[model samples]
Target: MNINIKKYLIITLLIFLIVNCTGNDSTYSVEVTNPLDSERIDEFVIINFDQLKITQAQQVNNLTVKNGETFIPSQLTDTDNDGTIDGVAVVLNFKPSESILLEINLNSPEKSKDDFIKRTYAEIAIKKSAEFKDGKYIGGNYENINNVKVPYNHIDHDNLFKYEGPGWESDKVGYRFYLDWRNAVDIFGKKTTDMVLQNVGVQALDQISEASYHSMSDWGADILKVGNSLGIGSVGMLDKGKVIMVSKTDSITCTVAENGIIKSDIRTRYYGWEVGNKKYNIQTDFSITAGSRLTFTEIQIDNEADNILTGIVKHENANLIKQESSIENDWSYLATFGEQTLFNDNLGMVIFYKNSELLEITEDEYSYIIVLKARNQKASYYFGAAWEKEKNGITGEKDFVSYLNETIQKLNNPIKLSYK
Candidate 1:
């Protein structure tokens, strides 16, 4: 045989072997399903690529799930601020029990975006400037409020430090706390695409004390009146029916984790409180997924006290209602609804608790509070607000209670995921 012909035959045989191997290769399979029918789902699902030894960016980038939907490997980071990227977090919409196929092509190009998943996010910001002063109206010199009372009373138009307090927001609602010893939490009703926290924080306060302070539109306004009450899920201790509040949060830290073009999740840590003889700590994690009417608040407090209390601020026009717990679900909610919005529209505030963990429900002249027996030196709960002005917002008391019930159901029956 001629040398050149033998060489060509060897090359052709190698090509044929490679094609056969590629054709027989098995595609990976992963099953992702939502418990609800056609509802958007946002939860942290752990993807253990470690077992498969797929740690590098290129390997993760080539991963796809159902319908050629690619993953966001470029924006991957240590979601928990840990040293390594432990797992993949996803936000997607799926029909009930929708099975998805996961495949990988190490040689394929990386995917730069994951936009098919509709995700709404939450934000938190704290901007502190000593240049604004510490007094109630000290910052008025720097930023002119023009003598207009900010729509939200907790905001001090004069003291920019008061404006420096921590501000949190979701697509459905927004909230801030007075860091200047008042320890009061206030609410901001939202309307537009709420992706900006720093802007919303300054704008909400600025608009209230500006020329249009009195003007109210559907887009948003400082809606909830906090006063000396707990506001929306603010924490205090109920010592023999007397509400005892900490003077202030001794140390505060905030974080914005998992921020993407379409989604965000934020956390605020208000720690080091000296209440009575015991020192306490509070951590709040808020998640606002797309199309959600309420922000999911996971509150954990550290203290030796047997019980911890959280509540809704009482208002003259706001009617307080308690939903009885069912034996099957073992969860109940205390809610308020009525024309309590700063704009005089319907607003709702709710706090959900487990029946087995609840010690009692009590209210004084200030708030409608729930007392939960602290287990393992901590208690967990969810609280949020809804405004009638927002699209598809809670329209009435019934709707508000219904939302709470549905949320409880979701918490009880979370979306289950498994691997094949």
Candidate 2:
């Protein structure tokens, strides 16, 4: 054979082998069942990639999920930020006691980020070149940042973070917490059902002051006045007969774990948390899913014997309602509804937790709290809010109560995913 012809033939053979090996596609069969008799709307379905009976090795980023021929709102997540996708997350619905079979197809043509409608978002934005006063960032052009250690001098209203601190949201609602001594979570009552957190504080509005996010725009407003209380589900440690905030920490770092089209989360680590002369490390994982009003939390105090607590901020006219689930001791909720929002409109706040973890339900001057005997210093709970002005949302107290009850039922009876 001629030398050039032989070289071309060899190259063509290699290309053919590579295409045959890498271009093949595979589908994973999944059967998801809703155990409850009631219909569940937008139930969060999450499964680890390892659970899928995958026949061929595939890249997680190039995966897609479909119900049939239609694409579903889904994403691959590495919740721990270890650079490896460990799970598949999707939002789905189920009829009364229905079972769903879904296809998780691997090696599908990778979808563009814009191809998926963004139902969830999270961010930590900071100014890069403005000014620092008293060892704190004052003002500058804001930009998205991640995995940053919280400076010791950083304090409340320092303008270090746009809208106080890291914010996360779903299509239903939004949330933010002050990354300072306050450590109180606040709610953003959205008027529209669209994803609005991205343009909240940074985007210029036509009919408001400089900080239009605080004022109600076409999107929403800062609805919660946190003050010195646990505005929503802020974590605390009951020490020396007092529930102290995560204030006295040797060092703290905030990381945006997974900000996505389907889910988003923030991981905050408080190292060497000192309370009552007892030093204990603490970490918290806060996540939100698409089309849901709930923010799920996993708090770790690093001390097994310690009882961690969380609370809903107190409002003058708010009515606190406590309800237990019908399933003996599985799940329950503590909620409050009234004119609690900053707009003087109706708002509802809730905390859903397992009944077994309940240690005490008590109150302070600033908040209504629940103390849980955290197992292994680790506990999981959920916090949520609803605004009456929200588009086609819960309006009255009866509707709010009904919403809470349905949420409790869904939590008590989760869907069962049977892999085929």
Candidate 3:
């Protein structure tokens, strides 16, 4: 019958060329290594694409990033809030002590989400100004200006509740927390990315309660001189050796959980009392990564107190360099250098202390401390600043202690991630 129908059409074309040349992949493989020999790491490999189904809007072209070179997955949708989409962060740069093997070919067809909406870089703002004051009650108003309220004075001499003060940014930096009562922790020294922390906190609160507008230097001022010290990373309590200072936080809370293409987390919560008498509560999560100048602060503390203190706001004309890290997942830095910052220029402040629970780096007469041990009460720190006037930032203190020992070796050699 025609030679058995030509052998059944050559056995159905050899089973469709062995199922299209064996690429039946639902692929997944992620193994990156940079054990650090000469030091060169710039990582972030996050991948969660809905727990790795690889983005199914038609398989998003199989999401490939083999050999290395992928970024643009940080539009931050649902970030573990469960609803979905907090996948793919990939920024890999490793070398010096390199060990790389990145492949997420999935079954590639080729497509991309290219830098995903530019990742935003980071931002947040909470402004007010209808002009209320020690009378309290100044709810949250944005965009427009009602002279705002809820600013107890620096850390709160008293007035408690009505949380949500304001301040946030990240093209490199910006911060605020003086919403009254000496809660002190202020900074806002930018050059550009200019949103300028709520117009420099309404011109330093109209130059402090209408002294009639002026200072705050055009746009980027308050270069870091947190008097009464412990200004940069704020929070103290080591007792016996003295460092109490904890008030104005009977309650406070702010948010912007995440708003970026690469980074911005601004979460805050600080509830009443801490200074041996206990009953404390502080939760700060602030992250500002996109090329970092440093602002990672994790700090949990529910007051089990094993260790907790932070610093770097002392200035007898700056110059307080202490560094420890003999390896063992490295970390310990407490820097300060020249001109005592704050408009005087040259400012550089640091306080890393990651791991080993960091037990000491103390000093008194207003700041240089870093005694952190709290593991269950949680603790993590990093606060950095460098301003020769921004552009290229850290230009001294040996490049700000080699960018704080390359961020303590990328937080003790992290970026070894693995996935199937």
TM-scores of the candidates are 0.71, 0.90, 0.30
What's the ranking of the predictions by TM-score, best on top?
Answer: 2, 1, 3
lDDT of 1 by residue, 126-200 (tens): 323323334343223233221111123223443443244545555566666654456666777777654434444
Provide the overall lDDT of each model, using Cα atoms, as 2-decimal numbers: 0.59, 0.82, 0.60
TM-score of 3: 0.30
Give residue 196's lDDT in candidate 1 (0 to 100).
Answer: 37
Query: In candidate 2, what are the lDDT values of residues 1-420, reduced to their tens digit?
Result: 899999999999999988766655356778899998888888898877767754325655567787877788787776444446777888898899888888876657855557878888899887678667676565566788987898778877667777878999998889988888888898888877788877877732211245677778788889998888888999997876687988878898898888988899988988888788778888888899988999999877775546889999999989999985444758899999999887899989999988888887888899989888879768889999989887787878999999988998788778788776
Q: What is the lDDT of residue 169 in candidate 3?
A: 57
Candidate 3: RMSD to truth:
19.5
How accurate locally is residue 307 in candidate 2, as Cα lDDT from 0 to 100?
86
- List, residue by residue over 347-404, the lDDT tens digit for candidate 3: 7777777657778776888777888888888887878777766656776778877777
Clashes (candidate 3)? 27
Residue 245 displacement (Å), model 3: 5.6
Superposing every Cα of model 1 onto the true structure, what RMSD results? 7.2
State candidate 1's TM-score. Answer: 0.71
Runs off by more than 4 Å, candidate 3: 1-33, 36-90, 93-124, 129-134, 137-140, 144-163, 167-181, 184-240, 244-260, 264-287, 290-329, 332-410, 414-420
Better of 1 and 2 by lDDT: 2
